[model samples]
Target: MIQNTVPGATRTQAQRTAATRAKLLDAAVDSLVEQGYSGISTQGIAKRAGVSRGAQLHHFPTKESLVVAAVEHLVDKRLMEILESQPDPEYGFEALFDAFTGPLFDAALELWVAARTDPALHAAMIQLERKVSDALRTGCLEIMGDRVSPDIIDLGIELARGFAVSALMRTPESDREFRERLLPVWKALVSK
Candidate 1:
């Protein structure tokens, strides 16, 4: 039933549903930013979106569902932004650097910390991994323009995500020190 509203094509119910789903998704992300997963509630999301609880329930009836939607939304927004920001086709690897150095890393780190005890959040992250992974892979290939392998791109994503988790941990060293030390890991990943 879902279709794209195009000039000549039929606008299917699915498109409408997807748009509504995205609305709730944007709201859920706002909620997560306001309150971590544990602090967000279905009713709160519904109210913030100006939709009834039942309407929210139509897409995500439970906290896990809402969390999943929000995670998906976050991943998509980030990937799109990264993809859209290509300086030029010639500077593709720079895109990868830009992605790892920015908000995407912080956002994922926050989720990783919160998901340690929350299975639903953890599982939702798996879905996010797929999206992020694909975006990284495609973005890398586009920038590398036949120089980089998808396998290496995948490895880069994995290593970057791991660094994001470890770098933000409580340690005797200061956060700045930890970030300064993060270079070796990045060096290991990109150096071939």
Candidate 2:
């Protein structure tokens, strides 16, 4: 008999399963960010994750399920990052805006666009998006504390998201200027 040793040898079956699922979900997010919605596939995700096709299917039986799960997983990870970060006394709003427009938004934008014409994907994304929005709202409240009204935070989120979307249509130079000009206005609004 041959002896077999692996790094996860001590992990329970459930732990191993969860690890594999996480790997697949992460790979799915990478695919979504890099390839857009139409470019993602079960086979590609499995290959990227270094897992078998059957394993991917075992975890998520459909493409919609896989993409939705990936979105939820990525949002949860980003929320944790936001919640655990130390707020900057001088540039908290700027930092928050940057975090909102980061890679998570890019990946989620791809899914949002795809969902417009995909009933199943749209159905799955609606709930996940709401969950993400709620989590982000709570995180923002915690970060800002009593410094700003809830309405200001809500407007700030919409403004940041709109800027992020508009950036996709133009060059980076204009986007930089736009943010530079808008930041003070946003700060003033929050200080009111």
Estimate the TM-score of every prediction. 0.68, 0.89
Prediction-by-prediction clash tally: 3, 0
Q: Where is the poorest 10-residue window by lDDT in model 2?
A: 1-10
TM match of model 2 to true structure: 0.89
Q: After superposition on all CA atoms, how large is the RMSD of candidate 1?
A: 5.3
Query: lDDT tens string, model 2, 1-192?
Result: 433346656766776798899999999988988999898899999999999999999999999899889888877887787677766644657755775576688888988899999999999998998897687677777887877777777777777777788888867788789889989987886786
Q: Write the per-residue lDDT of candidate 1 for residues 55-104, one digit (tens) a residue.
A: 78988877776766676667677667766765575455446545655444
Provide the global lDDT of candidate 2 against the true structure: 0.82
Give per-model CA RMSD. Answer: 5.3, 3.9
lDDT of each: 0.68, 0.82
True-structure Cα RMSD, model 2: 3.9
